[model samples]
Target: DIYAYGSTFRGGEVGVVIVNSGSSAHEISIGGLAVAVKAMGWLVTSNETSSSDPLSARGVMWNGQSSPQSFPLLSLGAYSASLSDDGVLIELPPYSAAGLVVYF
Candidate 1:
């Protein structure tokens, strides 16, 4: 199962949070925007495909970075979303979460 939540920010930016609970990948598209100029966000997922492995819990990576304490100011990599004809296209991996910001 996949869930998506979205809200508009103060500066006309749209923030979206997506969660995939099932053990399958999905490609989703979001619409109802004026014109999306940019899309960026962070993804959290484990190295293993399934979370059944106890050791996989320690393999969680945020935006491709394994260590969260390594950065002094909590910087997220420039993870981008693709702009589709319908709206914004995002890939949702199994048992993963993503937070995105869409600017118009």
Candidate 2:
């Protein structure tokens, strides 16, 4: 299953959250933007089999620190897209979540 939530700021910035809860991956397309901008996302997942264990996220440096081995801030690339006619596409992995932001 896939869940998405989006919000638009007064200044026209866009923030989106996409979550995939199932055991498979999916491709999602988003539209409605005035201009195209760089889109970035982080991959979050859990390593523990127990439900009580907390989840961890990778991609993008944290606290302005450069930990290339830790969080290798990733470009959306194949997982995300910029299309003609102001559209965005995203690929979500199973049991993962992406917090997407786009500037107009």
For all the candidates, what are their Cα RMSDs to the real structure? 2.8, 6.3
Q: Write the per-residue lDDT of candidate 1 for residues 11-104, one digit (tens) a residue.
A: 9998989998877888877786547787888888776655585235776677777647765525766688656557777788788888889887
In Å, residue 97's CA in model 2 sits off its true spot by 0.3
Candidate 2 residues 41-77, lDDT tens each? 5555444323442234333322222334532345223
For candidate 2, what is the TM-score?
0.59
Q: Give candidate 1 regions above 4 Å deviation.
A: 50-56, 69-76, 81-84
| lDDT (C-alpha) at residue 26 in model 2 | 89
90 in model 1: Cα distance from truth in Å? 0.8
Residue 69 in candidate 1, Cα distance off native in Å: 4.1
**Per-candidate TM-score against the hidden true structure:** 0.77, 0.59
